[model samples]
Target chain A: AQSVTQPDIHITVSEGASLELRCNYSYGATPYLFWYVQSPGQGLQLLLKYFSGDTLVQGIKGFEAEFKRSQSSFNLRKPSVHWSDAAEYFCALTYLCYNNNDMRFGAGTRLTVKP
Target chain B: EAGVAQSPRYKIIEKRQSVAFWCNPISGHATLYWYQQILGQGPKLLIQFQNNGVVDDSQLPKDRFSAERLKGVDSTLKIQPAKLEDSAVYLCASSFGTDTQYFGPGTRLTVL
Candidate 1:
């Protein structure tokens, strides 16, 4: 079965510090990976996605993710964290199954920006 | 384009009661999805519909949970005899046939 794993349950970083959230996936073939952010009391918003081609993908809100096939990981990174950047992050993947697309999500990691 | 829309942002009901949630996907979106998000956890897929037809519902608890997408536009998810575990944020999302899904401001259900 295809599954996503987010190793970090919670991460705290100082404002303006760099951030990296780890994600790993178990799948047979290449999968469509995505990063999504959810703010408190709000719906999830798409940050980035990796379909094919380039391994590094840029997304909204100054977020970026690099998909490494060898490591079976898609890690999200941000150069400088701001107070508003604190939120829950989820890594997801979609693959074909039973003649239809099946999407799976990781547990999610909560980020806290400390000043 | 307008994002997905959900109604009754929050609801409080007692256990054994019934509750329903409404969702209107973005215009021209053919795929609609219903997810359940528990506190401190990621969202779980409950059901997926493609143009008024069920695409995937394996994860949905059919015994007490039901959903429908009428005319391939609007949808409703209902739970009968709600349990305390059912208290979570119900999110509705839509996409264009395997494309990126846009989510609505989920409906938070509180079962007392």
Candidate 2:
């Protein structure tokens, strides 16, 4: 079974500060990775997804993630975070195979922005 | 385009009571998914349906939980004799194909 782990349970940052959230996955074959953000009382929104192509992919709100195959990591990064960026983030992993595409998500990392 | 819709937005029940959550997927969507999300955890797939037929439900607690997508448009997830551990948000999502899932504002279930 493929699983994802997000080491940070909660992170605090000030407005306009740089942010980085670590994610690691365990999968046998090539992996399809994704990052999602969930605000209070809102549905999960897709932040970014990496299926195939370049290792670095950019997402909304100036968020970006790099798919590092050697380390089995797809850490999310933001140059500067806005107050609105304070939300729970999740990392998910799925097999790249066309036959079985069941995806598994990490526990989640909550981000809090302090003024 | 209208996103996936779910209701009631909030549900509260005591342990051992019965509760149900309803979901309406996007028009023309062929796949619907039901997920259970415990507090501070990611949503876990409870069931998946491809047009009115079950695709995957291996993670569902079949002994006490049941879900159905009749007519291939709307879905309902029911829990009989709800348990305290079942207190969590029930999320409903759908996709145009099998690639990306668009989620709805989940129904928060609180079991007393």
Candidate 3:
């Protein structure tokens, strides 16, 4: 079965510090990976996605993710963290089941930007 | 363009009671989905519909849970005799073909 893993449950970083969130996925074939952010009391917003082609994909809100096929990882990175950047991050992969595609999400990682 | 819309942003109901959530997908989106998200966890898909037909619902608890996307636009999910474990956020999303899905502000259900 296809699955996604987010090793970090919660992370605290100083404002303006660099940030990186780890994600690993298990799948047999090439997978469509995605990153989503959810703010408190709000719906989830797409950050980035990797379908094919270049390994690195840039997304909204100054977020970027690199899909490392060898490591089976798609980690998200931000050059500098801001107070507004704190939120829950989720890594997901498109999976095929019962002849239809559905998304499987990892346990989310909550980010705290300490000012 | 308008994003996905959901009603009853928050609801508190007693166990064994019935509750319902409504969702209106983005105009022209052919695919609609409903997901359940527990606190501190990621969203899990419960049901999916392609147009007016059911595409996938392998994870939905069929005994007391039911959903329908009639006419392929708006949808409703209902739970009868809700359980305590059903306390979570219910999210609705929609997509155009295989494109990125747009989510609505979820309905937070608390079963006491």
What are the candidates' interface root-mean-square deviations?
1.5, 1.8, 1.5
Candidate 1 overall Cα lDDT vs. reference? 0.94
lDDT against the true structure, per candidate, is: 0.94, 0.91, 0.94
| Per-prediction TM-score to the true structure, in the order listed | 0.98, 0.96, 0.98
Docking class of 2: medium
Candidate 1 lDDT, B1-112, residue by residue in tens: 7999999899999999999999999999999999999998888999999999999999999999999998899999999989999999999999988788889999999999
Candidate 1 residue-wise lDDT, A1-115, digit = tens:
8899999999999999999999999999999999999999999999999999999999999999999999999999999999999999999999866535567889999999999
lDDT string for model 2 (A1-115, tens) is 6899999999999999999999999988778899999999878899999988999999988999999999999999999989999999999986634322466899999999999
Worst 10 residues of 3 chain A by lDDT: A95-104
lDDT tens readout by residue for model 3, A1-115:
8999999999999999999999999999889999999999999999999999999999999999999999999999999999999999999999555536699999999999998
DockQ of 2: 0.63
Q: Residue A73: error of model 1 in Å?
A: 0.4
Runs off by more than 4 Å, candidate 3: A96-99
Looking at model 3, give its docking quality level: medium
TM-score of the candidate numbered 2?
Answer: 0.96
Encode model 2's per-residue lDDT on B1-112: one tens digit a residue: 8999999999999999999999999899888989999998999989988889887888999999999988999999999989999999999988766777778999999999
Looking at model 1, the pairs that clash are none
- Displacement of residue B38 (Cα, Å) in model 3 is 0.9
Query: DockQ of candidates 1 onward, in order?
Result: 0.69, 0.63, 0.74
